[model samples]
Target: MVKDLKGVLAALDAQEPGSLLGLRETQWVDAKSGPYQLADHKAVEELTKDVAAFANGGGGVIVIGIATRPDHDEEVLAHIVGVDPAAVNVDQIRKLIRQRITPAPRGVRIGWSGADGERVLFIDVPAQAVDTLFVVPAPVGKPGSPRTDTVAVPMRDGDSTYWLPRSEIQQLLSAGVRALGMPTAQALIELVRHAVSEAGPGDGPRVGQGLPDREREMRVAYEQLAEAGLGQPAGEAWAQGSAALQDLHHERDGEPGWVLCLVVGCPPVVVAVPVWQAIVEAGRHAPGQSPLAAIGLPRPPAGTDTPWVIAADSRSVDVDGGSWGAGRMTCSGRGVWRWQPLPRFSLHQGRSAEIGTSGQTPALRLRAVVNLPWAEAGRLEISKPRRTLLEQQLPHSAVAGAVTMLSMRRGADLPAARWERGPFGNSARSVGYSCTIAGSHGGPALKASVRLALPTTMESTVVACADVLIEDAETWAAALGPGWETQLGFDEVQAVLLAAWETAAELLPDVVGDVAGLSWAAPPTTELRMTCEQPADNGVLPVLDEFVDLAPLGSNDGGPRSRMAVTIIAAPAMGRAERKSLLREALVRMAREFGYVDAEVDVV
Candidate 1:
């Protein structure tokens, strides 16, 4: 079933290949259409990841020359476009392992899967002992160049390849240093090599090649932190900081006035970077133009002009007199970062933040708060659309790292499940993708029922597409893991919104961009959610059972159009007007796809 990696690898892997014409990608299996491009350093790094991740986990199969379908609800394997065993360069694959991964993996076997012409390659990676973590070099500059100073620890969690978070990498190195009884300063220097990548990605570390500049940055930051006497206790530092902040005021035109200030202590600034990264991503609307610029202070690293603290010297309120970028970005996306001001109180929208960092960590508080117009409102505030955008950006940010510790006001109103200090995020994005970068990782399931319906009369082509969608929905539902037998209730609102959003993304992309520009640039946050309604009278087994891909295909040949529902009881009900509009749009879009262009949705 493992065919092409191109488009064939669409849905999740089934127990075996289905008639869907492709092998689904799953936690244990992956498919690719071509061999790794070893010439490109990034590709080589990727190849290292390809072999290492599988070896790191339960061990899995990487099938070369299989095409995959991209746009399906399930993991759809396309065709088995085999590789030439004669042309296979086994040494090249082996060479990448030596160049990148540390302590080369043991007993990785490569074999041919099919006969000639339809030949494909399969590399079986055996699981490794879990004592020490594996390391790999990171790609830099153009495709083939290697970053001498930086390396990443790649792991296969579920089906995704992820770099350990920078903090974790630091911890690992420090632990290694401790085991060897090395000095703390040397450990710190080793950690310094791993600089911040993209904002919010938790991209472990960018180790220096023992470069002097790298060591100097770490040394200076640590020295400043020591000078502040922050290592002894965070309370004292916070007290001093808060006391100093009270006297601060923004200069309006020429007059002094109250202004919001975003204060964060550095050295341990990495802790706060993710939160700030989310804010940056939420506000980012264009390239080379960042919303943070409006704040006037530098973006993160606590005091740098950019997002990296390693490359740029961090500005400090104590030293340089201002804040800066937090200096890390593992990945970038509209969803990677976010802003949501909970309803007033949670402390009534008043501003407060918890401090994080070690004495060994750097100290240099960063402060920059703008928005003079609504400065009195207190705390940061953003729209629901922005919230949605943040939810879509960091699907894999949580992988292999503990990069966030969400600190909220004590009086804030939040669900009990979220009261714990853990990764800062919600039920969207990764939950569905519950969902992560890895394929069929069986992550915690986040369920939102969606019911799709079809009218009694439609062209076979439309019916076919609709059927494919339904089957795809069912396939996705099936992938959610065991105990999914629960029946999906009707959610009219979700159905409509689902259709409308899908059609809008396809048809009016520009319009959506013009409107929700920040969110439009983000990846698709909503997954296809559909469920069929169960009959009140369960005794009767209908005649056309095989035809029904979903709960109940909308209508019979001559009966009224079938109805489907979608609902998320946990979600607060939307406004009445918006719900009605969504229903109308869903109908209109579905009808148009089914050849009803003039159809004006009136599905109140």
Candidate 2:
């Protein structure tokens, strides 16, 4: 059973089994009366949409082989109809979803449960860490309409699934999630103190001189949050049904002035452990450390001497009629530890301006929950400096960098010299690099400073995970479609591969010799042309068109020793034996270059 299955079962139990129903269809539950044989394309498409919808929303369950009565009102229960055990093939459905959904929903749990002496399929879809909306391509055509090109954002609204509106899509696209900014009332007071201390002497009222100004500003901030419907800071007479009022009267110990509090509720986190593990494994350090390191941050040290995770507290509360949980995950190393909560910030204002100004975007509220483990690994550490250093000497410096290249042939034939003049050329090449500088931070505990060697790329784990997901086969296949072919068994592929080897051989002439005993029995045809038989109505002469034709080979596994196979179509003028000999010579030369070998030779 999935972790949330108990909750789902509880929901189902609320309705009696024989009361003309089973469980009412809600935003999170979908009841279908029959088994989905994914071999049926329509069934596959429907399943894809439902999965996408549940992933986009707060995650939900799809109960197949469950019947519902239309005559009943909102309380209608979808009773069990039972699935055909023989017809159920979990692998096929899993594969279909993997092939069709872009950035395919992670942590999708599918199982069979017995009910009413019959088996029903339960598909539990987990909400994504971020707004990773799945886009499934429309298949050929509808029953009554001709084929058309379109995209879909399947989302669940109320009790049904539909393509979400453009406005909603825009909102999801622009929505941002950060670890709740300040996790506690004390943290907020500390931040205020830090801000005031950081300000120059000429800035707004100092702590003691700006007493009235501070009070007025605090009141204004409170009113702004109240007017925006975030609720009054706990103790106001107008406050009603406020359960999260623990910090209503919270204030800095030394500062007696009034203060405004604005709290925004956030979404519950859905942890997908396997996906999280994959991301961490793909990273450079410990099992789950790379996701954080890649984004220009240091991974917390882990071992027998250090704990992998330390959570201080966790709890759920009702806010603005929505239930949101706030919890902390801390990682410590070298006498430094940082706390990151589900609703990360205890108090934060989102504005691209100075802190004291009224630049806060009250109209725009932000909220997000951090997935456990993976997100836990990404919270920034707060270092405790033991000493201070004011050295006059320059520090030793070193540059760290890495580069990865994915090279491939583009055209069907050997490049025409003319192709070089065309913009972008014919061959395709992509390069990625990660570069960082080594630096040092020195200070005492009072300065709260420590040595720092950080990456220039400072992105959240959620963003970094999304980057890593791009390399996943399911994600790439779904995004590019089945027709995406990277390898073609054309002469051009061989040419490119050989050219690279030849260049390498130049630097190691002693190691690589000329195609030792191989000789061209017949000069290979480097170019082929086809001429049209007739001219157009303009009466122009017949013209010959040069074309590059290469048969698509299979995908490259992206390993250094992976073999590259090339197919060479012999010229029509060549004899069978001659073609075979030419093929043998080419294969031998390729082997000598340690590139690609000729797999086959075909003569028309």
Q: Candidate 2 — which residues are off by over 4 angstroms?
A: 1-6, 10-22, 72-75, 142-150, 166-604
Task: List TM-scores for all candidates, in order.
Answer: 0.28, 0.28
lDDT by residue (149-205, candidate 1, tens digit) is 677777776546787789988887667779856688876575554434221233332
Give the lowest summed-lDDT range of ten residues in model 2.
Answer: 394-403
Per residue, candidate 2 scores C-alpha lDDT tens digits across 1-604 of: 1223345643332221232244567888777888775656677778888888888787887877678776445534456677777778875676556546654555465665554456677776755645355766565444332122455788788778888777886565434211325545555566467545623343222221222323443344444333222221222111112211111211233211122222222211111222222222222221221222321211222222321211122121111221122212222333222222221112221121111112211111111111112222222222222111111110110000000111112212211111011111111111111111111221100000001111113321210000000112233233333454432234532333332222111211111122222111111111111112223458552221111122232222232321222222222123435533544444443333333233233310
Model 1: C-alpha RMSD to truth? 27.1
* Error at 466, model 1, angstroms: 62
